[model samples]
Target: MTTTQRDHPSIIQADGEYLAAIATGRFYPGVLLFRSPDLTRWEQLPHPLEQVEMPESGIVLDPDLSYVDGVYHLLYGTALSASESGFADSPICHVRAPSPHGPWSPPVLLHAKGFHPSLYHESGRSYLLWSEWDHRPGRDSFGGTWAQEFYRGTRRLTGRAHLVRGGARGARLHRRAGWYYLVAGGIAVARSPHLTGPFHPDPHGALVAEGGPGCLVEGRAGEWWLTAWPEGGCALGSETVVRAVDWAGDGWPRVGDARPATGAAAPVPPGGARVPAEPGSTARADGRLPAEPELTAPADERPPAEPEPLTHTDDFDATELAFCWQSVRRPPDPGWLSLGERPGWLRLRADESPASRHRVSLLARHQHQDCEFTVLLDAQPTHFQQLAGLIHYTDHTRWHWLHLTHHEQLGRCLAVLTSDNGQLAAPADPLPWPNGPVWLRALLQHGELRFTASADGGSWTGIGPPLPVSRGFLGVCATDLTGARLVCDVDRMSLRPLSSPR
Candidate 1:
């Protein structure tokens, strides 16, 4: 029998059973903390870093939370963010706290690149095993410091990413039956006991080299098991999977699930084949290997909390900003939109869409890759050109929209896409529906994005071309090149990511 820690976390955390992944707002990546109990059910805790700094250096990722004596130390990867991303360098930052969940100290910058760190103690000094980064010029991957070593101080470890090479991502180490094992890749594997030097990368670098279904865990049997994530994160997706790992006589790790093999290992003929390691240069002397590289990646997010029902709607009984509505990419103008005026209806006083180049009215964003997302609206325009509905967008490089605007007939709709060339017809349906009280929905699965509009909130029709969903943000927006303030009172609007079956 095997035990997998998830919902019931061994550690007691501040937030509830599952954590929420609060976006860092800007490109500053956000983190989710989980309190686990005996490696089973996990609970969410308060984030280590709350407010995103001005210039985000890098994100702290693959946070492996552990306790050293009484204080909690987290080993993680440091990452940088682009300017549009809200950061300057994106180096690896480390923060220490007296408690696992705490008034944590500031980020302790570790390295320029490198990611995913694991802390280990040898003799008396403490060290880290992190994923390495490539320093070589031109190449995008390979050869880094994914080894084992001791850290003397900030960013000063006994060794680099690859004790001798560099470039490691998912590095894991453990002593089994007195034999030491190293795992990485995201799944690369090599072994040694000394914790430094030349590693004969197992022909297969990952502990579970052949990945498919099952969680591969190295429990007591001197044996392992792997659980596969069947469909991965696509279906009612985001599900936690665990399995076992098994090994062959030659010490090879393979999968129990049937999947195609990665093209790395092909059998070449002997004699005419490349010779095995020269008996002399190959050293298995002391079980000592290289260091590990680091990684950076996301949050609480009850791994499976159904997105809260969106609060804002088409009925303007109350005036206020619904928390779910977000403004990322470009800084939003507070003056153009306000909840202080009416009650539930968000007021957008005609303003220029920082995201729009020529003349377009809409402020919205795409959240994830697949799923159903929507925003309900009602707009009052003194002039004619005005619209409110589902819009898709990301950086200035991409965008599209499906909305109902006022034409000669009162409520005319149109769908438009904007690329480097210019805005072309994308999708739109004449709801003949009033600019006020219309529900707009955007359905995006995989890559195809489409917008739908409904007058009575019952029957709906597709508005345009398969709009590309570029992970955009959604919110109430108004464009007034005409200097006309468009009061678009958003009654309710919300975005959602599909989840796996409970």
Candidate 2:
């Protein structure tokens, strides 16, 4: 199966369709949802918690999705604070909706003991599972997976929590053939005859020792698939990967050779259509066989074409910001961002410096691959405090900014400012700017970044020396460090991949 450019993906087959819930990290509109008729293709749905208030620090972690009793339940954890030691207060919250495209219920606080909360349903009862966090010195922080009775109707927990099995970083539970399988850290598996009990680890050790945490999903044909991410460093963050699963004669599950394959046959036949679950039927909830399959193509045929590259332009022609755009820590407030102020332009009133996590006005999208991000900015900064231009941002402390700011020596100028893990540096002198709207571009290729400016969008002049860096979220930003809300009008923005890496 093909991988997805999303983090901490929790997938489930619900209502005859495949639904995936993605961890949004520090971006606002928490918990992105995607729907797929067949596992090979996916389309993003509206965020479930777009209006919910998010924490100002750390990130919104593991979001798990499940379908129970004709309702879509979503469980997520928010890191309220963290230090060198570990997470100080991470609260697990729950919400539900009738459909994947949801009018979700308000979040209900579950527990603060740990994160990566997942839910398991059986025989009209539900259980909450998580990796217990123990912070005492010399103690294993994630030593065991805990399970407790969860009353979904009241949105609360009952009875005492039990240590069911060894600690799993991102624990998920699946029941098959009267045996309960506990998949953890996306690499190991444990089994037990009871829902919560003394579990036995797989004698073979880790299922896929080289992959990150993920969940197990059953295909339309009763075949099980494991979803995971690569363990090594990735420029685009942790992505969603799916691997074929086979059941051993002893009932234990094994991933293919414990390695991630570059390509594999999709779980469903090409162009297979989804068969919605019958209303009031608990068949899907209890691992019952799905209705007869509807195969649109032969099993030997190749899967659908690869998805198109992440390349698009925003002229601010629409009244609403596209779903691709996201803000840090908070949703883009209409108070500072407006498209109606000037038709065909995105009006951004600077709120606070990029370093301020509370109220940053920066809006950016994930950089899936090396591409050129260009923006047309029409701003005249009276002082260095008011700046506007393109930014390749990972977090506040690690980013490269090629902006138009006022300089004491060169009045209005373009300069490159970089922060490598909070150590700030200026790699090039400020280049004097011409007055009217200017075209700013950032070319990212082959682990190196180069900045240039153009007057008419034709002839380009280098603004800074090429700097080696990793790929990150690329977008336009305007900041007012002086606390005097300055304004910057972004006429247009475009992102396209280079023909080939240099």
Candidate 3:
């Protein structure tokens, strides 16, 4: 069966260019950006949030991108504070840039309502729509989708906030043919003549009921597509699945014919006649076929240059780190990690405890569905509880770690720890590892994780039984300890296909 792996997809077509934002936070860059000539062939663009550091224990969820009046805006939400019930108020943040690959403005707080905030522009007006949660008695955790207006220049919320639609969360807005359409939670769609009120819910109910949240994109040929994720038992992580939007005779946009997309092809807009390639022109580049361009758009709105294939592998050979390496909260401090400190090696100083959210020194890459990661660690631990090793992490809650540390009773040992929503479980006894440098390997196969270690860097020994790594895992979060300070020197860390050579 075929499936799409993109999730919480927010797409914008501006200046004849198509841009989609993928929600990736506390992993590598917070949001991953993609550009597509045709919605089918997407190319990774430079991530705008590569340097933005979200606080530890905080994560950016359901990112949205919009362009208006020459200014491009990006919005995302993060938990404002910890809550016991999993449903907590999160702050929606915004940033703007003149271009998608941008010198972006610093993040500005928009509101503390709920998650999945989206921005929409009309005629000359701007509006913010998001799910509102009510902790008050007798109200469902979610109060429903709410919206308010804002001044374009000020970027501040004005006017009273009002409920636009009821039911599911994750609100989105789009306008076509004098009618405004709203996508809620993912598949449930509604329409309204006025942007603010009186939205008409789909009588047929869910457009893609099982699908997660998504946004609408208008193709150059005037075709409307619902860029969403797979629904029902098929959904996984933040994976994305784009479905064709067909309008009923009554003018209501429906997602699909009810069935979840299983290798369903992306729909092309009418009038999307392919252009013949000319000699000496790389028109047929990156498998991206040419489509009809908006004659009304300025010349600069078209694809700039043929983008190179996005690389997930970083050798740490250069003095500077690549955008793929990210920490939980802030960008890793140079004092915590360095390439030049030890030539040909990435040195990580673990001065703070793993429990330290704000100042924790760690770096991780997003975990692919079927991949292998291997690293050589030269770690020396002096104090008990000082750990330097590999971890499969989601958030502060839900994680599994295998570390080389000094156990208070076991001296130098290798330990495994697992947490389900911050509740931890560990082996009663750690394996003795009073040896020199060791090689650690982590493999993710069908969403399960297996750990193995080698003292001589040749023969491998399994450390723990295979454990389920939740899709929520941000990636492999690791820390290093040095001297008496608990530091680990990672000579090299690599990620490759399970079938590829180690």
Candidate 4:
């Protein structure tokens, strides 16, 4: 699937020559048509359909494109009529062209009335299978009522393709041994002698795999496999892995070869991972992803440009988030983030807390393994105490946050990791860096958190003992502790993964 789109995942780098989807800026969904070679390098073909203001209906999923007979066919999820999730919610929308490179047809809202749609053509006629959702509130985020709502409540959209009405997501199928066997997310399988499934569910593949509710399909290599993301897993917001799917003596779909897709012919180093592909787009590595200099943003921050988020540029540049900051608000604020108004400064305005799980307010990307990053913040809030620094957090209430701020008693910028059931956890020791202004450094060396401070970028002072944390995204925050107004001014920041590139 495409990565980096604003709402639905954007298709950034594609198969060397096609750049299907892209982001115009950090805002609005920008779709690009790209071409690539060897999945490492990419080149953007002209734009097919670029929507300036993508409607925010949460009902409409991002549109996906694929080449069929040298022509392009775009499948997107859009709102037919609003409900718990429309027939078009996760269902498929259509846009086609006679040729791969051409003027795309207007998006056709092709769907039956009540199911969450997934587009695929087993035989000749394209099919849209989906589960209709009952989006009324408090209906259990997972389990129970929600399941019942999804089951009984979900009806296939009663439209043209009535036979393909049995879609409820998480389904996959492939060609092998003269069979087009299918598997849905609930771990259920339906077998069809042919593609147009007048299929029957095998008792076995009714439910398997873990994590959360997500759609899956055979891998690029067509091996028995699947990958899942948490329910409402904000499109490509999380790193999803591919796992192998197995089969029983009776052709029942089972989990097998569950390793992720590398987009490359080779595999990633141990513990490293990649986001598997979906029906649309292929993966490419050495392509046009921002020249991530130990984690920095590309100068062209708009569409047609890529950001160096975590690609290892080795320098933070103040404009980048130092790979150690994660957002921690329940209804996390999207506006609470920005980079490069001043080129080398990371700024944080105030934002609302997240509402529940997966809804983090501040921005948190990844930090490398056994690394060191310097974080420097220069700010004094008028209303609330503006806090900014790196973190290794899990959730709003879980994990640890190591940052700099103005402590009430100390009356100076202090370095601390606040983690207590109640009240902010005090610094492991008093502020180590000079009160006024200085460079704060935290090193993740062999699982130990060693902190050092420098008044000038050259000199240094030890903060204290290293803090300990699990392998996770290094977080950063710009919270307004007192008023609804916390802001931070930063001089500079940088991250260096001690190990050399492989």
Candidate 5:
């Protein structure tokens, strides 16, 4: 996977176009959706689940999308408790809609057996597939892939769950040329003549032996393609990549070179040729797909141009926040966040402490590469309980904060705080600031972090010593440690990349 901070990508062809859904992990609105015409150049669609009320510290994981009989089914797991060993009490849920851009139905509970749930449909029947988590001592946590019958009309699962394939996780079932192929974690492939029978490992070995997990899809010309995320040193996290799949004479699929390539041929031709729909397809008339841009190159001839580094500026001029901004653990509640309250500024009411996982007034976007983030903050705290500033956040236990707070001796001041795995420390003494809106900036480059502040927008002054860090979310936050609801106004914010990672 390689672009724009996405994970566990699952793509399927629907209505002559390709659709993708990915896990949101610790963020609200469970899954993110995207559409493509040529298997490249994706446009983000409206999220399926808009408002999800999860348990405290619950996270959405491994979302999978599939289309059948005019309805698009989305399957995902919500992990209520997790540790380094494995997840506990993770429940798989299901939702369906007429289209990916949807007013989706409420999530229906499927089972709590495991995570990474996927739906497989055949002969007008649907089956739920997932990796079974084993907690026995001295045994692998990933027991195997299990399958059970799912009744769409009744909206419930029936029959006893049974193991289909063992020794691998994230197993996806596909049929090509009269053979059932089980691609597990993109690391191994097994074949079975029957859908629920003994599966044998491929004699030619796995299709992709290296890199991250992948999903296989057929192209417009009936050729095979692999949508995968190859592991590497990337600041933006894993990115989605497409590779060509070769079929052996013995009916096995193969990715010629196991390594991720920088470029590959386009799956469809210049005019965005549509794939032929399956036989007896009953797609609804209202399910119109998005328009695809016309390209100039022929199929398998030229690759699409690589996307440039991300740069964005938010003046809080719009009525609602853009899709790029995401809050931690919960959706941005209007009760604590507002754009119309102030004409041109964003008003954020302080929530719980920064260390609290339940609720925190923080809004951030993914940091894709070496970049600089600047914000104009206007906040005045009567005591040391309130803080508002820029943060480079990985999670609750790890982050770097450059905040403005009140000090007993120094009055209103600025300070730098660091948290490594929940161990908190103040790296620099507080610096007194004059009463007014201040421009705070954070520069992240080559795994090091530095902070600077400016009275005006031009001249900058360093505040804290350089500290080692890693790539994560960059955003502004306001918190009141004493539980008093204080307000922080952000006039403007911007981000620009210092260097691009190709």
Candidate 6:
């Protein structure tokens, strides 16, 4: 079944807005950001670091944002994959801006060691926290939690780094009742009466809340709450959960029943702000909820915005590209990925030489594992290695793609190619290319994938047997990507669930 798509949920309350950031790895220009007036209905804001680039090859994972002293500070982890050898460490970087929206400063290196970095501030003191990986032969388990004094304005670390705890991620800190509560992979505590310390785990040393890794936030009502991303919600991706927290007699925050909150609760703000009256419904027309609103209006009269659909269809009818389209690393180069150049069609200029994931002229949307992605491609490739089609891309190392290209010997054909690690699979039987508009579709259900094509948008025909699907996601990445150019016009694209009627 389909599920609400969110993961690595990092959220904080700032500037009277609850800003939530989720990890969108390898989908360059990743990290989806959402802001809610109340806490329930989150609307996606323009990705803050959509244009930020890292050196060489790496993925940006688990970004954290905190607004301090009239500036919004963003920090994220960038490193080569663990599978890659040599200097295996992910370094965290920091960027700041006057506002969460727009004109962020360039990324500056911070700490090095592991991924999933977070920022915590207490009483005018800033701290940068991250996982520490020790890869000296026998340190197999994940490294412990480490912290260092951070200067947001200067984007530099100060003083000596300290090992706060062991073997954890998403390490979070909050102070209450003179206890510095620490929740990393599991619940822990440090009663040092100070923000930074010689912290210690709970006396009981047992997991208080067992569902998933999450952070703690106090509500307007002086009650503490916990938010986590529990697994096994859906086939698509991870889901967000919020729960109430209580303090125990032993001085530890008693995170009540590990079960994720599936119901409404008051938000974490002053004056008792609460979830929206309707699920996924914006509290105000302009996304600004009055401190107090007259609730005399009927539920049916409220804006009937439906829950976000898993499927979307774009016909290239608008002058501007849809917000779903994002480039791999930085902003999409207008020279390669353009809309106005082709009137009603989206023209993607496919270069002959394959470039890095960051430089390809591909615009793609995040796709679930069990969904159908259908696109109408109108292309006329006349040279070898000149191809254009749909890509099931996880990253540069792992992917499966089906494209239409031409060769002097093979003429026009359809090829399905798959790659894992760095080994490439030879393309499958080259199917005879059909004339006119080529409609290509990728049917990914559970763990099975099938590629189909049609002369028209309807009346489809299978190109080959169903191939085993990878846990990877669907995106567009092409090769034969530089030097000479091949233009492919995408007429239309649509995504739908497998069980749903077409």
Give the Cα lDDT of each candidate. 0.45, 0.76, 0.67, 0.43, 0.75, 0.64
TM-score-best of 5 and 6: 5
Residue 201 of model 5 has an lDDT of 82
The TM-score that candidate 2 achieves is 0.87
TM-scores for every predicted model? 0.58, 0.87, 0.80, 0.52, 0.86, 0.79
- Alpha carbon lDDT of residue 56, candidate 5? 67
Model 2 misses residue 476 by how many Å? 1.4
With a 3 Å backbone cut-off (N, CA, C), the pairs that clash in candidate 2 are 144-167
* Winner of 1 and 2 under lDDT: 2
Instruction: Give lDDT tens digits, candidate 3, residues 323-364.
Output: 556666666667677888888778877765445556666777
Per-residue lDDT of candidate 1, residues 353-376 (tens digit): 435433333444325546567767
lDDT head-to-head 2 vs 6, winner? 2
Error of model 5, residue 82, in angstroms: 2.0
Worst lDDT window (10 residues) for model 2?
266-275
lDDT of 6 at 280: 36
Q: Supply candidate 2's per-residue lDDT for 67.
A: 85
Distance from true location, Cα of 102 in model 2, Å? 1.1
Candidate 5 residue runs with Cα over 4 Å from true position: 84-87, 231-233, 258-309
TM-score result, candidate 4: 0.52
Candidate 3 Cα deviation (angstroms), residue 355: 4.4
Task: Compose the digit string of candidate 4's lDDT tens values, residues 197-276.
Answer: 45566543344445432234333454444444423343223433334465444445455433322233321223211112
Candidate ranking under lDDT, highest first, comes to 2, 5, 3, 6, 1, 4
Tens-place lDDT per residue, model 2, 330-409, is 87777889999889899888877677677888888777447788899888888998888898888878889988899988
